[model samples]
Each structure stands twice: as structure tokens, then as C-alpha cells.
Target: MATAFKQIEDEAIEMARSVAYSMPIEDIDMTDSARFVDNTHWAFFERLRKEAPVHYCANGRFGPFWSVTRYKDIMAVDTNHAVFSSEAHLGGITAKDQEDDFILPMFIAMDQPKHDVQRKAVSPIVAPANLAVLEVLIRERAQKIFDNLPINEPFDWVDRVSIELTTQMLATLFDFPWEDRRKLTYWSDVTTIDVSAPDAKMTRDEQRAILIECLTYFTGLWNARVNAAPAGDLISMMAHNPSMRDMQPMEYLGNLLLLIVGGNDTTRNSITGGLLFLNENPGEYQKLRDNPALIESMVPEIVRYQTPLAHMRRTALQDTILGGQHIKKGDRVVMWYVSGNRDETEIENADAFIIDRARPRQHLSFGFGIHRCVGNRLAEMQLKIVWEEILKRWPMIEVIEPPVRVKSAFVKGYERMMVRIPG
Candidate 1:
């Protein structure tokens, strides 16, 4: 399967390269992760925002779709959930159209009453009270992780720091076994990896096997939680909550994937991205070092700059007009959060990384309206704690070279980031 995917990826990259030079930017399908992995999507999106904020691509990898590139336009679509649906059955929430076999009915991909009810069930895990408890645990874990790293020697920060810290937090969220937490990171990466990308290590069958293993492990946890009293962990919350207690097997798997990816990607990438961004902008790093308190504002800026989840795809429920363009029922409309975060109109000097921006939180890294990221506050808290602890220990964690980035349009993340902590 990997062999096949490699072939497809090769063709996709060639196609992207060809279209990049030949076709008008608006007509180019930015859905190809290949374009993103190569870092060419930035210019493509810039053109879209300037020329065609509500542009249509008649032929895209995921079939035809409209790209909503501007911040205001994305907000309008995000807030108007009635016209633009996130329901999984109606092509789900991605530019890469959901396949029937791969459908997982998570609340993020659902609509209205069902989405609200199910979301309510697990909202407590990230609620203010829970976050306060998690903060102490997160700091303790960050200390342990930082203490164990090799000093004065180059190591992969993505694996040692970013993935480790997030995976630890994820385990705490689910009450997953400490030793088996790495499996959560594996599953999260596998869940979002584009099989066609060269970086995808597993074959299709292998990926399925791992996911089945994840479901099976969680099913055991769910079964145990169902019989026990209510608890703070995600599984226990779902088990005890009336709305989610009777979820179908696939539905359970779907929610599990959602929670895993949701918990894992955003913070993990931001941790790695914050390092890379600081390396790129030495002045910001110095500002942060001189005034460690800036971490409060810097955390959200990292999320915006990273834009972990690049886009959220919404389906047109009925014929509608968005940004003065006629959108047909069933047409896929993708809100490019990555592009919107950089829109100069909404964010001043949006392209630059300013830690102390007045309105730092006004970014679309977390989608707006009903389907906004449920664990966003939790993610921000984790990043804040990690950075706070990091500043206490190392003065600098220098990137050895350019970080190896993830090859996916959906998850804007890092694969490998080598760094050295100066002794």
C-alpha cells in the first residue's frame, strides 16, 4: 500500500509543480498535501486572499471545493452552521472528501442537537476546574521530561519534548497507562497521516491494524468505566454521560480519534513550532527570555503562527451565497485557517510573530462558532506550562537545521526537529 501511495504522492507533487507554474493561482487545488509539505501553499493562498477570497477550484484532489481564504469570510461560514454543515454523513469536515469506509461520526463532524449533546458530555475534562488540576500534573511531567534530556548533544525535539509532553498530557486526560502512552502518539500520527505522502511509514493495512488496536484498548477502558462510578477522565466522562453511554462502536472509535488527534496535534506542533519560530525571530526569543511572563501572550501567538489544523471543511447544506459567490447544495467549502491567520486585514503585521500583540487571541487557529475546538483552552494551558518550565531550565534549545515538517494539509505539524540544549 505504501508503494502505491508513494506513486500517487509522486504524481501529486508533479501535478502541483506543473499547476503552480502553468495555471492561475485561483484554479490551483491547494488540497494536495504535497504542495503544503514543499511550503508552496503560502504563495498560493496569498494569491487567493488577494484576488479570490471565495475562489472555486473545479478540479481538486478531493473533488471540487471553494476556498475561503479571508478571516472575515471564514468567520461568516463558521458561524453560519445552518447553511454550511460539518456533519460526517454530508462529506464530513475536510477538503479530502470522507470515504464511506472511513467515516467516523465524531461530534466535531456532526451537526446541531447531536453535536451539542455529545460535546457537552466530554466538555468537563477541559473545563476550568479540571484545567487547574491538570496544570500541576502538566508541570510535574514537563519537569521530568526536561530533566531526562541529553545536554550539549543534538536530539530530536519532536520526539523527546513535543510528542512526549503532549502524549503524557493525553494519557493523563484519558487515564491511559503511563508506559503505553507512546501508542497514543503513534495512533494520533497515523490517524492524520496522508498515506500518499512519502513520510507515511506504514502501509494501509498496517495503519488499520494499529487503529483497531487503539479501539480495542479503549473499548476495554470504556467497558471498565461503564461499570464504575463517574470520573474526570475522558473515557469515564463518556461512559457516565447519558448522551455518549450508548455510542456505536465506530462512533466510539470516531470520538476517540477526535480526542486523540485533538489533544495531540495542536500542542505538540506548537511546542515544536515555538522553538522554530524563536530560532527564526531571535528578538522575540530575547523578549520572552527577558520577560518570561510574556509566555501568557506568546502561547496563543504560537498557536496562530503554527495553525496546527490548517483547514476545516464544511459542506453546503443548501444553495447559498458566500462572499458573493453562488454555492450549490453539497458543495464543499473549506475554511483555510492557516491562510486566515495570516490575513493582514484582520491581524496587524500578521506575517510577523509578535508575542505581545494587543489582540493576540483573535486568531482562527481554533475554528469559530459551534464546532470550535473543545480542548483549545487545555492545549493553551499545556503549552503555557511547558514553556514556563522550559524557560526555567534551558536558556536556549537551538534548532540544528530546518525542521522536517509533516506532509499533510489537515495537520500542520512537525515530523522531526533536531535541537541542542547548550550546557
Candidate 2:
């Protein structure tokens, strides 16, 4: 019986690997890992870190692209913004040509002069000093969200909780009116990674129509806020800035949309991912519960483990050598944050979950260098506060079912993470 069971399991594993090989992404759906990862993605990344750290991925969509999977290599490429530029507008951050005339350029999707000028305006809002002002309110919001969590009953964390809190917080940050805040989150979803989702079939004209509608709707807010003084919100900062003062009405709205979407989707996904990771590693969950003081250290561990944004793409401006490999100019480069966070060299027991792992913040979820996530502080604060509140309310939250991942290669996220919290 044991031999037969073992044979059956081996065959099942082999079949899963075969299925993984047949698709472009394995387990992209949160519930399915086979959609994005098989033995191959891991083996390839591990081998590349050792043999060809700056190797080319011929299977990618945006032409053949180079991949930087190791911690050091990603740092090298990310920090050297001059060579590995983020100015690829045609196909946002992922190494895919899916963006069909998407015009909303994130601060992360542009190169300097433009990137630097724009990043400076709201950078202050997310700075460590300024973030403290928002911490109390964030904590309050978190407490409220967790207090309502359904205990001992299966619930979709991504939809019922994570997205709700995240989008609401984003709406708060933008000072958007409560009645229309859902619209802000809706447009944000369409703006960010809609090209790769089920919604991608919208006609080109329809896409343009949505873009125009988004701009037109937000332009009213922009114009309204232009006359008002700075009120400690993102909209005010963008509208009244000296640099942005004479900017085209739509240009400012585009950036605001970027901040809302970028800040909302990524962190929300991670919150769900974090819970799922804890669910999978129950021993680690116990470790966290045993030491409430370790939450700070665990935040980085969770970020590294979950990797909110799986990867970010950069374009090589000129032919150059990286990781002992030669690369041509304008070659697409992928910084696999998920793989890099798992690099054994930098992370001791990289595969294991260590709550108090020293220097856990070294993970690359926020990328690095000039184009690192502008809202890093804010993300950390929100995640920490939310988890703290979650533990406070229900010390026992468990994954009842595997997550249902977004069917997106880009913005890789958990769409439905069925979990049970103690009643």
C-alpha cells in the first residue's frame, strides 16, 4: 500500500511539473502554484544565480529579456538606473508587451529628470517623519478592520478585507470623497494591470474611452484642488506644486492615479499573501504568536516571503556586461524580487521562515536605488499595524483553503484567500 501510494504521488508530481512547463506562468492564480512555478523556474533561477547571474530569458514576452535573480545582481542593476532604465512606456514594468496604449506612467516607470522631479513632490508625505502623523489613524483603521473579521468561518481575505482596507486607506490618502472612493479604486485597477487580466478584451476604443473618462473625472478634482491650499493630502501636493503648477491637467491626474493604484494593489496583495504564508507555515505562525514583540522583524520576513510584486523589468540602455554575461542595448532585464529574496547566500536558511531573521528588510520588494518604491515607509507601516491589530483581535487565523491567485502574470496577487479566524 505504501509503495502504491508513493508511486501515485510521484506520478501526480510529475504531471504537475508537465503542466507547469506547458504554461507561461505557474500558479499565477493564488490558488495554483503550477501556473507560474514548477521545478524549472526555481532550478533556472538557482542556476542563473550561480552560472549566469545576468542571463537572458528567451521565453519572455517583451522580446528576449535578461534576468537578475540574485540579491547582489538585482541590487547592481536596480541601483545603476542610468544603465538599467525604467523608461519603458510601451510595456510597463513586467517583461510583457501587454500594455496596448496604456498612458498612465508611474513614477517607477520613468527615468530621471522626469522621475526625479515628480518623486520629490510627494516623497515628503511618505517620509519617516511625516508618516508618524498618519500612524495613529492607520492603526485605528486597522483595529476596526480586524475587529470585524469573521472567526471560525471561511472568508476571502483579499476581497472581504485586504482590498477593502487598502483601497479605503488610499482613498483617505488622496482625500477622495467616501461616496466616490470605490470609483478611485476601480479606475486604479483598470489603470494598473488590467491589460493582462480577464478585462483585457475591452476594445482599443473602449480602452481609450476609459482613459479619457478617468482623466476627465479626475481633472475636475485636480481643478477643484488647484484653487484650494495644501490640505495634507496627495491631491493637494500634486495640484499646487510649483513644478506641477503649470503642468497639464491630465499629467497631474495620471501621476495621482499611479500613486493610488501602485500603493493600493501591491500592499493589499501582500497582506493576503502574508496571511497565507503564515497559514502554510503553521509552525512559523506559532513562532510569531509566541513572540508578539517579533512583529517588526517578521514584517520583512513576510515581505520577503510573499514578495508583493513578483518582479520588475528594466531596459538596458546600451550593450554591457552584467553577471559575466554580455547584453545588447535596449535589452529587457527582469529583477526577480521573489527569487532574489530566496537567495541562499544572502538569506540564511532562505527557504525557511525565521521570524527574527536579522536584516530582514534587505529583501527587494521595494526594488532598489533611484526607482525603489516611493511609498516603502507607508507600506511597512500599514502592514505592521494591520498584523498587529489582527493578532490582537484573533490570535488564531488559519488558511482553510489555498488562495485563489489573480490570473495575472503582472501584479501577481491573491484574489481569493479563504481563511478562518477564531470566533
Candidate 3:
């Protein structure tokens, strides 16, 4: 049964590769959400990396934009904040432009001093001491989650494991109400949903209404925290810090959404991805079984293989030459971290998921430069703890079917994945 599923997936990939090669270079649009849903975006990105490392799409779904698809090229753009900007007013960190009336000015979207100060306000949450404390809590929770799994029966790994664990962690970080923790997961999903997709769950208006509810609820918590003595939670940190304390309502909402999504998506998706990859590559699974100590390297490899948060967008602050192409000021520049992670020039046999690579951490998943993921160590610790607990208990957790992927070019994640753990 597993072989049959693998064959079907392989054929679909071959068909995608064929179409990718046949299509004209000028017509390829990476922003199409359908490609991501079908998991065919791999071929599109592969073509872009080889032929047009810095290609421009004249009429993208969002707008005209340049695609930076190589590892070195992506690194160059990511590190050069002076010339390439992530300003929210300039459309923020996504290929899709922010709505004119709905601009959310988070730190990641700001440049220079403002971005630094605001980021510093919440940076202590992931300090080494904080992570040391989190590791103990994560392991205990992971054990409880694993102990409750249904034996010898199929269940949705995404719902049962991935979403639940990540959402719980998000709730802890915000010091949110424990019973309403799933709200964080829901808001994270809504924040990244491709509203234009045919299968979209809600319209833009509906999404806005829900997000406003989230802001209202968090605003109450913020107000409460502001009056109390400083605490360790993110809300308390932001409330106490001078740099973040004076933020406007929309700015507050924007940073809230950023922390929620940033904390949720990357870790959640990689947790699910790790299981699926291990199942797909049984040899690597066997290698893991032989040496459980490999978990240190396996975690980052899983992150790289998943490449959650597929791309980050920047606007050209001024005219610049990137990959020999002239980028005009104010033009949208998208660095495809997904493609860059798979660049063969930088990573040998990049397409293959080899668990024990000598340099497992040398990938673009966590990104680079000042705007890199702040909770990266926390993320790694959670993944490491989950796998450690899993190895001590289950010998194997079988992925019974292909994962239903999220319908967004930006967030590469699973919506559902059926799995069974043998009794």
C-alpha cells in the first residue's frame, strides 16, 4: 500500500517536471496557490533556479514581482536591508501585497532602529536560560501527548499532534487562557490563508472580522499586563518595554499576528514533516533506529526538508543589481527560501533527504540576517524533545496516506495526515 502511494506521488512529480520544462519561461508564475496545493511548486522552482535565478513576472496574481530562486542570490537579498526593504507600507514580507486599508506594521516589516528596538523587546523570551527551562516543560508535555495517542487505529497526525502541541506552546508564550488555546492556531491559519483560492474557507471580510476578535481578546490581556508588575510572558514583556508599550492598535495586532504565525506555522509543519519524511525514506528511519543520538542533526534536516514559510518578500528600496538583473526601486522582490534550501550548488544532492549530513544546519529554513526567526532555538528544542519521546515509545508511526497540504504559496504546511501507531 505504501509502495502504491509512493508510485502515484512519483508519477505526479514526473508529470509536473514535464510540464515545467515545456512551459515558456515568461509564463511561469510561482504565486499560484494551486501549484502548492498539488505539491508541484517544486518543479516550477527547480526551473527558476536553473534558468532564471532572478526572473520577473510581469503580471503575477498579487502584482509584478521578481523571484530570487538561488541560495547565494537569496542570501544577498536577505542580508541587504539597506537596498532591499521589508517595510509593511511597501507590502511587507509576502509576495501578496498588504491591503491598503489593512496595513500591519510589525518589526519584521520595519527597517533599521525601529525594527531593532521592537525586536529586542520580545527577544529575551528565547534566551538560553528561557530555552533551558522550556526544554523540561516541552518533554513532559510531549510525553503526555504521546501517551494519549490511540494505538492500532488511524488518526489525523496534524490535528492530534502537530497543531495541538504548537498551539499549546503559543498559549504558554502569550500567557493566554489555557482552555482557549486553539484560538491561536485558528488565528494563525486565518492570517496566512490565500483568500483568492477557490477552496478558501472564508472571504476577506470574514477573515478581518475574526482577526479583529483576536485583537480584541489580546488587547484585554495587554491592558491587564500593562497595569501589573512585569512578568515573563510575551504580553508582559511587550507591555513593560518602552519600545513596544506605546504601539498603536493596528501595530499591536500586526506584531501579535507575526508572533502567533511565526511561533505556530514553522514548528507545527516541521513536526508533521519529520514523521512523513522518515516514513518516506525508510532507510533513514532505520539509520535513526540504529543511532538515536542523530536527533541533534535530524531536527534541522527536517526543518530544511519541510522549508516551512516558503518565501519572504522584500521591496527594493532603491535600484539594485541582483543576479545580474536590474531591480527597480519599489519593485517587489521575493526570496524563495524553499528553492534556496534545495540549491545543488550550495547543498550536495539537495533533493535527497539524507539525515546524517555533516553540516545539517546550513540551510535557509530559519533564514538569515537581522530579520531571521527569533524563536529558532525554541523551535529546535521542541522538535528535539518530540522526537526523543517518540523514539523511547513507538518503534514506528506509519503515515497511511499523503498529507493534505495547506493551500498557500507562502506557508508550506500540512492540513491533515492520516497515521497509525502499531499496538
Please identify model 1 stretches exceeding 4 Å from their true place.
1-22, 196-200
Name the top lDDT candidate. 3
lDDT, candidate 2, at 141:
77
* Lowest lDDT block of 10, candidate 2: 25-34
Q: Local error of candidate 3 at 28, Å?
A: 0.5
Measured on C-alpha atoms, candidate 1 has an lDDT of 0.88
For every model shown, what is its TM-score relative to the native structure? 0.93, 0.87, 0.99
Q: Model 1 Cα displacement at 245 (Å)?
A: 0.9
Q: Where is model 3 more than 4 Å wrong at Cα?
A: none
How far in Å is the alpha carbon of 83 misplaced in model 1?
Answer: 0.5
TM-score of 1: 0.93
lDDT of 1 by residue, 75-107 (tens): 999999989999898889878766678678999
Question: Between candidates 1 and 2, which one is better according to lDDT?
Answer: 1
Once superposed on the true structure, which residue ranges of model 2 sit more than 4 Å away at CA?
1-34, 37-44, 89-92, 97-102, 194-205
Is candidate 1 or 3 superior in TM-score?
3
